[model samples]
Target: MARTPSAMKYHRQSEKRRLDNRARKSTIRTFTKKALAAADSGDVDAAAKYQKVVQGLVDRAAKGSTLHKNTAARRKARLAKRINAAKASQGSA
Candidate 1:
C-alpha cells in the first residue's frame, strides 16, 4: 500500500534487505548447528574449525546489524565453551 513513488521504492528496497538479512541469519544458524553437532560428537578439531567459521559469521552479522553485539558475543562464548569442554573430554579419553 505504498502510494507515493518514493514510498514504493523504499518498500522495494526494504524487501530486498529483508531477504538478504534472512539469508544471512539462516546461514549463521546452519553453521552454528554444524559446530554444535561436531562438539557433541566429540570431534574437537572439526568443532573448533566450525566454531571459527560461526564466529566470523556472527561477527559479520553483528557488524551488519543483523544480530545484536551482545547476542553475537554470547553465541561465540557458548560455542567456545562447548569446544573447550570437548577438548578436555578428548584429552581425558
Candidate 2:
C-alpha cells in the first residue's frame, strides 16, 4: 500500500508503535486494577503501594503521549480517592 520507501518504513514503524502502545496501555490497566483490588480489600498499605505503581504508569503514559495528561491526572485522582476512602473506612473500623 505504501508507494515510497519512506512511506513503507513509516508503515512498519507505525505497526511496531501500535503494538508497543497496546502493551503499555494494557500494563497501565493491570496496575490500575491491582490498586482498585487492594482498595476493595481494605488493605491500606497494599493499596498505597499499588497506587504508587499506578501513578508511575499514568505518568509514563502521559509522558509518552499514549494518554492525555489531563486524562491521566483524572485517573490518578479517581484512584487516589478510592484508596483514601478505603484507608479512612479501615481506620474507622
Candidate 3:
C-alpha cells in the first residue's frame, strides 16, 4: 500500500527494526528468567552475575530506544529486589 518509493523504503526499515527489537526483548526476558532461576535456587553468586548481565542489556536496549529509560530502570530495580529477597530468605543474603 506504500505508493511512494520513500514510503516503501521506510516500511522496510520499520519492519526490520520491529524484528530486531522483538529479538532484543526476547533476549532480555531469557536473561531475566535465568537470573530469577538462579536466585530461586539460592545461588547468590550466579544470580548476581546474571542480574548484572540483564542490567547491562536493559541499559543498552534503553539507550538504543528499544525500551524506555524508566521501564528499563524499573525492571532492573525489581529484578535486584527479587534477587535480594530470595537471598535474604535463604538465611544468608
Candidate 4:
C-alpha cells in the first residue's frame, strides 16, 4: 500500500533484496548440513572439505549482511569443532 512513487520503488527493491537474502541463507544452511552429515558419517576428509566451503559461504553472507558476523563466526567454530571431534573419534577407533 505504498501511495508515493518513491515508496513504491523502495518496496519493490526491498522485496527483491528479501528474496535474494532468503536464497543466500538457504544455501548457507544446505552447506552447513552437508558438512555436519559428512562429519557424522566419520568422513573426516570430506567433512573438512565441506566445512571449508561452508566457511566461505558464511563469511560471504556475513559480509553481505545476510547473516550477522558473530553468528557466522560461531557457526564456523561449531562446525570445525564437530569435524575435529569426528577426526579424534575416528583416530581412536
Measured by lDDT, the strongest candidate is 3
Best by TM-score, which number?
A: 4
Q: Report how far residue 21 has shifted in candidate 1, in Å.
A: 0.7
TM-score, cand. 3: 0.94
Model 4 TM-score on a 0 to 1 scale: 0.96
lDDT of 4 by residue, 1-93 (tens): 999999999999999999999999999889889999999998889899999999999999899878999999999999999999999999999
Lowest lDDT sum, 10 consecutive residues, model 3, at 84-93
For every model shown, what is its TM-score relative to the native structure?
A: 0.94, 0.94, 0.94, 0.96
Model 2, 15-76: lDDT tens per residue? Answer: 99899889999998998898899899877898899889989988998998789999999999
**Tens digits of per-residue lDDT for model 3 on 1-93?**
898999999999999999999999999999999999999999989999999999999999999989999999999999999998988898853
40 Cα displacement, candidate 1 (Å)? 0.8
lDDT of 1 by residue, 1-93 (tens): 999999999999999999999999999899989988998898888988999899999999999879999999999998899889989988999
lDDT of each: 0.92, 0.91, 0.96, 0.93
lDDT of 3: 0.96
Reference-based lDDT, residue 72, model 1: 94
Which ranges in model 1 have alpha carbons more than 4 Å from their true place?
none
Clashes of each: 0, 0, 0, 0
